[model samples]
Target: MVTSLYIMLLGHLINRAFYYLKQKWESRALPSPESHPASQGVLPMYPG
Candidate 1:
């Protein structure tokens, strides 16, 4: 019924939001100096 449809829509929106946020965080985290092979030997990576 209407309630089922609403719940489905809400679940879809929440899943999409979580997926987007995880991708955004991983993109920002995966490229730091500590993870980068070239920078690992040269300098310490500091979190800002």
Candidate 2:
């Protein structure tokens, strides 16, 4: 019974960690203003 409980807790922790890592990866992979060509190329006439 104790072993089964430990296994269940471990499984939950692993699943939570997987989701947290996936979210972190997705946030880093997304493109932002810095990734735009115009932003990286020439300065804008006026700051928007």
Candidate 3:
């Protein structure tokens, strides 16, 4: 169905976006946490 295709596309897009975002994030020189913080689940926003 067309709805299924749309859902699949949205899922793929979200996966790719997260992948790229993580790549861009690690490329930064941001310091690692002093110990993993509770906020660690919140990735930094891409400033581009």
Candidate 4:
């Protein structure tokens, strides 16, 4: 069915996006001091 095909396409897109982001992050060495402000924008990894 077309609906099932659409769902499968969407799932593939999401998986690809996550994989790309992971690869991009891995290639990066580190952020500069100027970008420290961005850290504030991120929620703690483990929000205990």
The candidate, 2 or 3, that scores higher on TM-score is 2
Model 3, C-alpha of 40: deviation from truth (Å): 14
Q: How well does model 1 score by local distance difference test?
A: 0.66
How far residue 19's Cα lies from its native spot in candidate 3, in Å, is 0.4
RMSD of each: 8.4, 11.7, 4.2, 8.0
Tens-digit lDDT string for candidate 2 (1-48): 999999999999999998787666545654454555565325333233
TM-score of 3: 0.55
Please report the candidate that would top TM-score against the real structure: 1
| Better structure of 2 and 4 per TM-score | 2
Q: Could you say which candidate leads in lDDT?
A: 3
Candidate 2, which ten residues in sequence have the lowest lDDT sum?
39-48
Candidate 2 accuracy as lDDT: 0.63
lDDT ranking from best candidate downward:
3, 1, 2, 4
Question: Which regions in candidate 1 have their CA more than 4 angstroms from the true location?
Answer: 32-48
Candidate 4 whole-model C-alpha lDDT, 0 to 1: 0.60
lDDT of 1 by residue, 1-48 (tens): 999999999999999998787667656765764556665434333333
Greater-lDDT candidate between 2 and 4: 2
Which ranges in model 4 have alpha carbons more than 4 Å from their true place? 29-48
CA lDDT of each candidate? 0.66, 0.63, 0.68, 0.60
Clash tally for model 4: 0
Off by over 4 Å in 3: 29-48
How far residue 39's Cα lies from its native spot in candidate 2, in Å, is 28
Superposed model 2: Cα runs more than 4 Å off: 32-48
